[model samples]
Target: MSRRVLITGGASGLGLALANAFLGRGDQVLIGDLAETRPDSLPDGADYISLDVRSQQDWDAALAHVRETWGALDVLVNNAGVATGGRIDVEAISDWERVLDINLLGVVRGCQTFTPLLKEQRSGHIVNTASLAGLVHGPGMSSYNAAKAGVVALSETLGFELAPWDIHVSVICPAFFRTNLHESLQGKDIAMEATAVKLITKAQMTADEVAATVLKGIDGHKRVILTDRLGRQAYWTKRLVRPAYNHFATKAGAKLARKTRDA
Candidate 1:
């Protein structure tokens, strides 16, 4: 039987790759995003919906579409998120709110709306796209780091609460793949952005590679999915060797601070 999968921010980047992967596996795929789409870009059998993740009304409507069409949702990828970075004290409060509203609260709304539906069905997956920044903090990414960390925490809580219902909860913590995520930044921190781009461009994985990891995660019912090897190492380094991780982080942070000042 084909599963019904709904992916937010599915017009491009990791979301689009995920939609394609599910579709290739014969699942009914729905692409929800605020970005404009080209018909050629969408997989031939996939569906698209205009979704601004910030709005509850939009989420309800998407859920309704799934309920009406498939009668049940097998997966909900709360993957839509925007980036905002800068020195915490230097950034505007409103900017931080916007980032949290879309990145963190957006995931919250999806879980709130879909958990009941999936619980009633007694089977489903909820995959939230958090970031490596959530696990390990970096300089000049205060808003993004906080928002993704919230997502990580939220996913963990849901893992416990939704287990009895057979609803799998997975949070993806990816070290930057080549994506438009950097372009989505609303920060004035030029050096931070440049450094981020440099580091990400040096990465070996693509969105498709990360999407494959997500597919493996779904099949294995993994609790936490880390896409990049670096992310996996960092996660362990922080947990198992706190002092070394802190020292490394401090040094990297200082270098970034210098870059930011120069920029």
Candidate 2:
């Protein structure tokens, strides 16, 4: 059966790719973004709404619109997020707060607003886009890591809570993919170290590949979706040797800090 899918941040990047994937699978797609104009060309039955995920009013309005138009929503993809870079010592507190507000609280708001509707239907899926940063600590992304880690926790808790209502919840943990995330990273108050930039740029997968992984995860009712080999390996490494992992991460972080200072 075709599903009614709503994706936040669907104007571009991984969200847009997910929207297209669902549309191609015969699902009805509603894309919510801050973009002023919808893409000029979209698949049939795909719609776009201008939305700010940080706004409760926008969430309410978008849900109402989806409920009215689709009658029932089958999937909600919380894919909107921002990245931050810098040493924690130098990073502004407001930057951490802003990243958390958009990346973590935004997901909280989406779930809180939509859970009731999803419960009424008794069947739905909620997919939150976390990152590899969520599962393990990394250099130069303290704010981003903290936010995504919160998302992972929230998604896991939601999974257990919503299980009674038959609503499946999944957290997506993708390593790096080619996307406009660089622009979001650039907007951060702190500068990205050359090493960090190189690491991100070396990612081989496209946004479409991550999108496909997300769909497969949802279809299989996976609790966590590690979209690439790096993500999977990082997850297991952390799980198998947490102390060793932390020690290594601490050393790497110190090295990155020295490099940033030297630059």
Number of the predicted model whose TM-score against the real structure is largest: 1
Candidate 1 C-alpha lDDT tens digits along 73-168? 999999998867777657789888889999999999999999989999998999999999999997788888999999999999999999999889
Q: Give candidate 2's whole-model lDDT.
A: 0.86
Against the true structure, whose lDDT is highest?
1
User: How high is each candidate's TM-score?
Assistant: 0.95, 0.94
lDDT agreement with native, every candidate: 0.87, 0.86
Worst 10 residues of 2 by lDDT: 186-195
